[model samples]
Target: MKEGSRLLDEMNDRSREVFRRVVEAYIESGEPVGSRTLTRTLSEKVSAATIRNVMQDLEFLGLLDSPHVSAGRIPTQLGLRMFVDGLLEVRDLDHHDREKLDATLGAGAGDVGGLLDRVGAALSGVTHGASLVLTPKHEAPMKHIEFVSLGHDRALVVLVFADGHVENRLFAPPPGQTPSSMREAANFLNAMIEGKTLSELRRDMAREIAARRQELNSLAAEMIETGMAMWEGEADNSARLIVRGRANLLGGEAEAEELDRIRTLFDDLERKRDIAEFLQLAETGEGVRIFIGSENKLFSLSGSSLVVSPYMNADRKIIGAVGVIGPTRLNYGRIVPIVDYTAQLVGKLIAERSER
Candidate 1:
């Protein structure tokens, strides 16, 4: 083999042992490790000096880091990435794990919203970390729209789209509006805005109303604006985020100061748009994606890790992603395959649902 390939092969074999030790030490103590610990604990018969030399080589290759002089080495983000990609070994979920997940996720058949929440909760519970599920944005083309008037200047806007998706948005009308005006606005939209995307509808309505302002009554125009504005906000906040088990991060393994930091992290997650955008990056890729340490800007401050896998629809279109976020010392060998398999399970379930 060529020198590069030979080096790669050697590194592959050697790093497996190194990565195993690094992961175990990190998990047990949540601290960086030195060669002495590995030399003492590793089953291999290497001397401490020899282990130190190998660790230096690993560090030179960017997989290990020495946080302090004379202290043990820790797996850097790049090291974690390599371990996940090349060294990690994972097994299928055991029967108990499968049973737990199935019971939690399979509880609400045919209810996509409830199923998503349950999946998030189950993932978080199993991982003992915060879990996130990104739901598919409504991509179906608009088939029809209708507005129903309610009392107190409020109206319900029902949107029917081509893919059998229906959503209702309640719009509060402008002050002093009546049922007659609301009906007029709805009729105008039904006649003019069928088969339009939400953006198209908004733009066309603005242009048409601007041109015909002189011919229309003020109440009708105001009602139209109200209805358009209602769904517009919904479109902007399109991506749905389901998060569960954030409180699980509070106690175990994390220090008191770390808990405070995690509380802020949970607060940030409550702002769904941020987490949605973060998962959006993961949904663009195939297979499992690992964000280690500073690799992901959002969780860099917390020194966290995220493993995500994109879920797809029947047409092979990526619709969403599911993942777990935890401290960087997480077991990549174990969690990577778990997240990936769960994503496949989710995709299969969604496909089955679409068929039904």
Candidate 2:
């Protein structure tokens, strides 16, 4: 049997009942649950002394903890994991939420950008936490490319992909470049952008430069090489990340003591790298993944939780991930299926668009 199941079995009936009550109480109130609270909540009317003894036993087993010397007991991260794995009674996705997602996300496949926006917003609203969506590794073919000078030796590369997604990338021009040379470089790249991904475009550029370096002027060659190298390295290597519903974290019954943690959370959110790191924990997994506090180091400062699931294409290959970031006290049973169902919808919509 699994370790979690075996741990559950090791507990006598009374201890198990008290442990479940404490976990549920923590979920409901985000506070340490004391023996008196469990005494009032549990259906079997166990005495406070008996419940206290059981709590100490659970603490000894590494399942429960006390924040202060005198504080009530709360489920430790390991305890949460055991409760989730062994006792979490996950039900099917709610019919109302399913209909809401279908109505909101069923269409708009042509514009992947707008579709992602709706997805982030819907997840944020339904789960009452921040939602994160990582765009797939840019498989769409390049349809067009433009170089616009930003007037500080910097230029923006406007890329239009065949999947109707547009993105902008920036690169610093090598010293002593001209607009005409920029135009020449763009013209060269445009010729090869058709039906080719960024990776393909890089290969084509490398070949062209090697075989015909003399065919192009010195400045244009530098621009072409520099721009292509930057684009391929930056765009292809990093998946675009979308985050929404940050304000929800600050809303509702936020205790004053939690303000510092919330501030830290906002800092983590502002750094896209941290959010990406949280989702990175899910990239290798199969289905819904749960990373509680300390499990996600980047968010551990804020005591946050990450629940993500990989969205797949029709080929059953993982295209991207979608999920929420909330306090560690998230309603795991409810939010887990919400994220799973959202990922399925996202994958289905992408697949439908691909069939066209």
CA lDDT, every prediction? 0.74, 0.82
Number of the predicted model whose lDDT against the real structure is largest: 2
Per-candidate TM vs. native? 0.71, 0.77
**Superposition-based RMSD of candidate 1 using all C-alpha atoms, in angstroms:** 6.3
Q: Give the TM-score of candidate 2.
A: 0.77
Off by over 4 Å in 1: 1-16, 60-62, 68-71, 140-192, 197-237
Model number with the top TM-score: 2
In candidate 1, what residue range of length 10 has the lowest lDDT sum? 230-239
| lDDT (tens digit, per residue) of candidate 2 on 189-286 | 89878999877888888999999899888999998888865654444334667789988988787887676787787676565435445445666777
Model 1: how far residue 31 lies from native, Å: 3.4
Native-vs-model 2 lDDT?
0.82
lDDT of 1: 0.74
Candidate 2 clashing pairs?
Answer: none
